[model samples]
Target: MQGVPYLRLLGLVVALTVVTSVIMLIPDWNGEQASTAAPKIDQLLDVAIILSSFVFSVVMVMLGYSIHRWRARPGDESDGAPLHGNTRLEIAWTAIPTAIVLILAAYSWIVLDDMEATASNAMPVEVTGQQYAWSFEYPDENIQADELHVVKDRQVAVEMRALDVLHSFWVPEWRVKRDAVPGAPGSGIDDDFVVTPDRAGTFTLVCTELCGLGHATMRAPVVVHETQAEFDRWAAEQEPIPPEQPQPAAASSA
Candidate 1:
């Protein structure tokens, strides 16, 4: 009899968690999984969602049950019985939350490790972000292009840098974003977004950070080539960008 309420609450929480998690997982929450890093990252996010759903269910069920069961009755003024907190339940909640946090941290580390894993035959592309545009430079080919071109099934090790103000390199399909820090020569600007694009298609490279008025238009094309030959053919036809351009729109995304 003492455990009847606890059992009922547990059942309600479980039911709510299941329903919430299924509803949350039904949609393509993160868009198409276009990069090699997408699956693992998405999996990690799903785990978090499910965990959050369970936590939310617990809180909601407990709050509702307490409100209904322990409500003050509409009667004459009377004193309520004095009670102390349940030490066991308190310890349980603290320990459970700490354990949950540790589990999430461990899983996050694994996904991050996979995202940062080094790969052979990685392509290097310099990602430059300014107030209003993005420019991609192929250091090896010495070709500067407005479009960020990479070979499919290959790792694109992007070296990110900002010119005018702080910017961020974000492609939603890539499932990972990194900040482009502005720096002068020898200023130790070290940041990169390592992405292995599996799909061969064009995606938009957007600046997630708010830089300036033109920030909304600060977008470029991310073209993934199906083969090395195709990428080379396209690269061969592009002209190197001039040393400087006053109008950023002319050089890159307008």
Candidate 2:
């Protein structure tokens, strides 16, 4: 009888873990993994899901069993047995969770360190965010455009700043996000991050921050060229727009 309950609990846990893992992995939750760091991010998510499923299953099964096994009888109003805490069980639970947390923390630190490592020969692109639009500037080519274009399989270092208010640059496929804060005293001018796109495709770059009335429409197209020559060709075809010249102070009214 003693082993029967343990066997049932073990069966329940295995069943729950399998069902939960399938549900978690079946959905296209994180979307396409286009950047070099995206695969690592997705792996971390899977680890979290597996751990969470086991923890949830254990808690739920124990709680359900306790409620059913200790339920009061239909017409008997009597106090239940006064149970003292089990020191061994308490210590086991505490130690197990602490160990799990430490392991998770260490794994996460490794992933973060690798993701933030600087890449050599990264292409620089300046990004400006405003009330309702995003603009990109290629400093090397001296061209500004509404869309961002980069070479596939190359690292891109983005320097982003907000012209008016706060905004966030997020590309779902790239699995990276950074904030663009206004250039004020003590406030950072441009926040930067590097992303190496592994696939050549069109992605959407949207402002994840709520800045103003037109926040919902603050989005731009991101094009990842399959080859460096293709990107160079596109850049060569683009001409820099000249800055508008102001009239000579209305012919000096005074």
Candidate 3:
């Protein structure tokens, strides 16, 4: 009788697990990647989350079922089944959970190591965050601006910083978001990344941090150009077009 209950519980767990695991393949709504490296990382995380959801669902369902099936019936208020726990059941549960933990831990470590390892020697770009705006600094060109421009397939490392309050640089399409904190070193709050744009176009970089009252107004554009030459031309031409001298208002009515 005990074995039958355990089997039923296990079956319920498996069913719920499978259903939730399958749901993991669905795409995330806020996903983006500014570089090829980050998107792959995001995808891996999504997969892991799905797998975890499956496991979680299984555990939850089994727990719920056990509560319902083994609860004291209306007629029985006295002692239930004798307190003789199954050694095999206890060991199986412990061993299986230990094995899962070890496997997941190893997998997570490997993924982290791989992500941090450097890859292609793509050019780097410095992304600076301030109170109410973002500035993209090109290390090679010695220029900074309110907009960021990069070749579609090139690697870009955003060296981030906050002049005042904390700000998070987030680009949905590139799936890259990192905090820009005050007074850090090296890359500071900067996060290294790379992006290969499957489609070339302009995208918005919205500040994910709440710096101040004008936090909602802080935003920038990332222009992904088709070729390096095009990007160079655009970059060369980004100098401010001086504002025309102010003229007096047109003659008022006589």
Candidate 4:
């Protein structure tokens, strides 16, 4: 029957989609889930991968079948039967894809809202980006250091600013990135974002934007302390060393 071939094609599409989706999800595409937002971000990415794989499988299968089924035989130059487009099929495809897009858009919006939600007790950390280095300041502790340090399980609100040109603050494990502009509008130049590190480890922070000649060397270390006490100790250690006082020449010429 005519329906048999269509059903077989549908089955093939479904099978290939599943196989490809699993393959896409299986590898360690993301390095590690260090931040609280990692799980939600990963889930959203997985959904995207599944949808994309399904669409790809459907398109490829249909194209392959059409080519194989309608190819001209050797020495056959006669014109094929004339056919018109199916209005119902066209409407179905258009409506289905539009619906899918709307649903995904809604879902993505919700996820972004949740990820960017602010915390009441988030610690404020000032971030400064220069041509070849980064500096982090803990305003509450009055500590300034080249390395970023924060306590685990606490949300850190990073207020970022760029000293020279445009730069982007990115920590791959945190699953969030924001731009640091020099002189934009009201507070837009000083962008801020909250990140909660769930695990205690060191992560790499890099500037994604092409700043200048030393762009490749523009990287810093982010250390997530295991406890508040540990972070406090580290902050205390960062206190500035007192300037050595002049000894008055120690009774010159005694």
Candidate 5:
């Protein structure tokens, strides 16, 4: 009787959850995890998916069940019975969702904090983005290249800036993206971001933002070397950025 409806609702919710989770949450939805931060980001995504699936399942099941079980009978057109809100149920629903939101907020902060906490020995790479290309500069080594090359299992602090329009630096496997804002040399609208690449492979650095005419073609290669020796070897072969020539004695300062 009453218990039967509850049991059926529970079964429906379970089945719906399984099906939805399989469709939306599983099957490599977040793509490859190649950085230390990637796993944490992926875990957060999984939690979000699970919560949303359950909420959607409960709502849809209840809506359908109520429509079917309480439809008006034939020739019985009349005002529906007045129903008062259940204080306990309302409070429970409000409190539960509030708790879920708080939990998610806390988890999201933790992930960002962990990722933003740069290591003491992290390598620095200045990344510049133009309308249709990206460049990587290793200041310490005085190396410059169109493609990014870094050592695997090492943290890279990306000093990012845009020459013209806004650009975004995104490495799919890293699961993090940061915007590069256009600014003057020392105007300092900072857009610095960091990532620790754990995987040694060739990835692509793509601009997620719609910057302008050649936006679709704005992509560069990223190479993560397996060892310091490999990275050093590559670095030794690249052309160094030419040192800026000193301006002619500043026109005899007043």
Candidate 6:
């Protein structure tokens, strides 16, 4: 009967929806998402994508079947059946997409606002970029060095500046990546978020933007100190080089 195909289609759609949702229910937190409020945002976006995929798949399937099953047989092409429009169906489809888009846009703006608000109180750390090297400057201690040092449970706001050319500051583990532009207003500047280091170890800071021939070597290390004392000791070690070993005074006298 005609109803049988409709029933079957509904059953298939329901089955597919349930299966996909169940699969996405599993949470994977590498580290960055574990600390920030990004997990909720991620879940919302995932739902949107899943809904889109479901709709796209269903439409494609229906279109393919119509093209094949409803094709004219032999020479019986008598201008198919009369075409008709469904006003209610058109309104429903259009309104649903518009509502989803509006909701997503509002949610995204709220999240961005939260991030910028929290940035004001973050601890400042200056990040300097150059050919095959990256140095971190702690204005609080008047120290500058090639390696980055940070204490646990502290919020760090990095101000990145490029020495030679354009580059990008990227740290995958922290879910932070910003371009280190050259000469542009607000150029050579960016920030990142690292609330806590549950796992103490080194992470790579790569130059995302292509600078030059040594671009591959333009990488740095981000070290998360175990304690504030350790960080202080490291900071002291990087103090400006003392006046080159006081050269022996020439034997003047005579």
TM-score of 3: 0.76
Flag regions of model 1 displaced more than 4 Å: 1-4, 184-190, 241-254
Once model 2 is optimally superposed onto the true structure by TM-score, how far is the C-alpha of residue 43 displaced, in angstroms? 1.3
Cα misplacement distance, residue 84 of candidate 3 (Å): 8.7
lDDT of 5 at 3: 43
Model 3, stretches more than 4 Å misplaced?
27-34, 79-102, 117-121, 186-198, 240-254
Better of 2 and 3 by lDDT: 2
Per-residue lDDT of model 4, residues 1-254, tens digit only: 14439888999999999999999999878779899999988998999899889888989898898898888999999998877877977997898788878888998999888988999989999888879899887778877889999989999998887767898899899888888886532453548889899999999999999999999999999999999999988998995423552333432332
Q: Which scores higher on TM-score, 5 or 6?
A: 5
- Which residue pairs show backbone clashes in model 2? none
Each model's total of backbone clashes: 0, 0, 12, 0, 0, 0
Compared with the true structure, all predictions reach lDDT values of: 0.87, 0.85, 0.71, 0.85, 0.88, 0.65
Clashing pairs in 1: none
Candidate 3 lDDT, 1-254, residue by residue in tens: 44566666667777777777667656564455555556566756766676677579766976787797788878887987587777987897798768777877787777666655554766678777877999876767656667988888766656776667798887787765778876533534344544445447899899998899989999998888989899888878765423452323542223
| Error of model 5, residue 3, in angstroms | 9.2
- Poorest stretch of ten by lDDT in candidate 1: 245-254
What is the TM-score of each predicted model, taking all chains together?
0.90, 0.86, 0.76, 0.87, 0.86, 0.71
User: What RMSD does model 1 have?
Assistant: 4.4
Higher-TM-score candidate of 1 and 3: 1
Candidate 1, 136-155: lDDT as tens digits: 88877878888899999999
Judge candidate 6 at residue 249 and give its lDDT: 53
What lDDT does candidate 4 reach at residue 165? 88
Candidate with best TM-score = 1
What CA RMSD would you report for each candidate? 4.4, 5.3, 9.2, 8.4, 4.3, 8.4
Error of 3 at 71 (Å): 1.9
Pairs in steric clash, model 5 = none
